[model samples]
Target: MNQSRKLCQLCGLPLTEDQSFLSLLGIMSTDSNNLCEDCCNQLVLINDIFCPNCGRLQATPEMCFDCIRWQNKGYPLLEHRAIYQYNDVMKTYMQQYKFNGDFLLKDLFNHDLIRLIDSIDKDIVVPIPVSHYTMQTRGFNQVSGMLNGQTLSDILSVTASKKDHQSQFGRRERMNRQQPFALSVSSQLVVGQRILLVDDVYTTGNTMYHAANLLYQAGAKTVKSISLAR
Candidate 1:
């Protein structure tokens, strides 16, 4: 679609056109039109000064306290990157997309996610799986939809549970979550392969670590991660 005619994915404002000659080359892509100027400015992108391990926005490029603690507690540390800081704008977008089940909102970061996934050099990308209950209620796995056609290995599934949302739990409770994820019985495909885990958000890092632990035990050679927000 043409830029001026396209509605912003987040705010629904009409976008301005890119009059550059690249438009004629079919290279002036959706990135330039999906987010209007105002909504774009609201996004706080992660800078070089963020945590190297978890991508948490911080003053220095050191591993965040949580990641350090994870290693101390005998969990394998995941090298991570995030596209945006978890600010108020991201919180609102997450609520609208994940909680409210607005599946279309997944495109809000489509272009960026494609770029991020393209840069990652891994044998396979595995999106963190949601529980069956979440799939039935929310109608989709939020992380799975944001994966823009990368190499996917569906190696994990959430075990049946009666648990509440992760966001509703305290930090200690979140960290203490039981093994809610399990490898598919046929998931021997990741053996000795580099794996990259993708998820929508990194709150306490519990969920990703849980999946990574399972992947590592299942014989994955290495495990890294990327999330849309941190």
Candidate 2:
């Protein structure tokens, strides 16, 4: 019998244990598998209702007050959504990707992102960029790699930087990325196009707001944003 080779569910990249980037249990590194260990975690955490507006997991079967207020206020904050709450499970995996050099979680965590938004019609996928410091330390943009494209466009580019701002949350980790986010489409590339922005997380959304604002200034007519988890 000919066994079908396992390919990454997100990027369609072929996986082999011998040289796989990471390993999942019961999945031999020397054998073919669909995802590396980092990606496998995407499938494990489930069974919860996250607020559609803020994506916060709830304990009492009630809507998140923050999301409710956000909606009432006309969503000036953001059209935010996430698949999972930042529970211990989601938090551990995110830390692994952000600090430990596992870029694979982008696909694991955001597998449904583009699929859900494709119907809205976007010409480009702009990833939110990390500051020069974080980029130097992390070595890559997790946002850029998450939608690393099995089906999205082949071109992936980031074009601007905004001045970092103090964070509202008072959490240093949040402020570490305080640099203003920026995105530029060549005047020729986006005169009247609709675009969607992608990012790994959406906390205060200052980043998304700044990025969308830049894209809009560059001539985008409509902008929608998405993140893997908040």
Candidate 3:
């Protein structure tokens, strides 16, 4: 008689009292999954009070200020979501993801992503699109790479900007609040589908909004977002 062993979902190691619950959260995503319970619980966002769309911090259930502005003139995906807050750790991780090219972390990143997709009541998956310059310089789009070889990649595709839009992250982020994010969906892919855009972070949320609006304009039934952290 034998028993199967359990592994931590964050670092993917044999489970310990503190690390055993990482996989239980169902989004730790490491091959070995060695997350101690703290990260499993702490890293995950829960019971947040936010704008249903764009996942921005909202005072109440009603549309947040960003969404209101978008309605006047911005991307209008049916919904949007982000999983974490932008901070020092998140910044470091994202920088590492972009520059260092940590493809393996997709397991961790997309693990939460999968949870976001399944947990949040949404439709399709549209990972955020990076500009041409960033992609060329980085050698890859982290979002696209995350979805690659996964079930959702078939539905989502990258549509980069024409030139090197490599401006400051903050400035670019603010611009995305209402900036144009041109995306193309195939005929087969089109025709009234509910969509969920994915991204690494959710700061001003202009980028996700633009993307959502694009999908809505393209006849998507609904456009939503999934972020690892807000």
Q: How high is the lDDT of residue 151 in model 3?
A: 51
Write candidate 1's Cα lDDT for 178-212 as tens digits. Answer: 87799885557878889999998988889999999
Better of 1 and 3 by lDDT: 1
Runs off by more than 4 Å, candidate 3: 1-46, 57-62, 74-77, 120-123, 153-166, 169-180, 184-188
TM-score of every prediction relative to native = 0.88, 0.59, 0.69
lDDT of each: 0.81, 0.55, 0.59
Q: Which candidate number would show the highest TM-score if scored against the true structure?
A: 1
Top-lDDT candidate index: 1
Model 2: how large is the Cα RMSD against the reference?
7.7
Q: Write the per-residue lDDT of candidate 3 for residues 1-230, one digit (tens) a residue.
A: 11135554434445564343445565454322444444444453534687876666556877787667767774444466676655555565576667777665555566556655777554456667666566777777787676644455334344545442424446645564344455454635645777767777776666666666566666778666777667
Candidate 2 wrongly placed segments (more than 4 Å): 1-77, 104-106, 150-179
Over 4 Å off, model 1: 1-5, 16-30
Between candidates 1 and 2, the one scoring higher on TM-score is: 1
Local accuracy of candidate 2 as per-residue lDDT tens digits, 58-116: 55545576556545654334455554445555566567778888775555634466555
- Model 1 clash pairs are none
Error of 3 at 195 (Å): 1.7
Residue pairs clashing, model 2: 17-29, 164-179
Candidate 2 lDDT score at position 158: 37
Cα deviation at 31, candidate 1, in Å, is 2.0
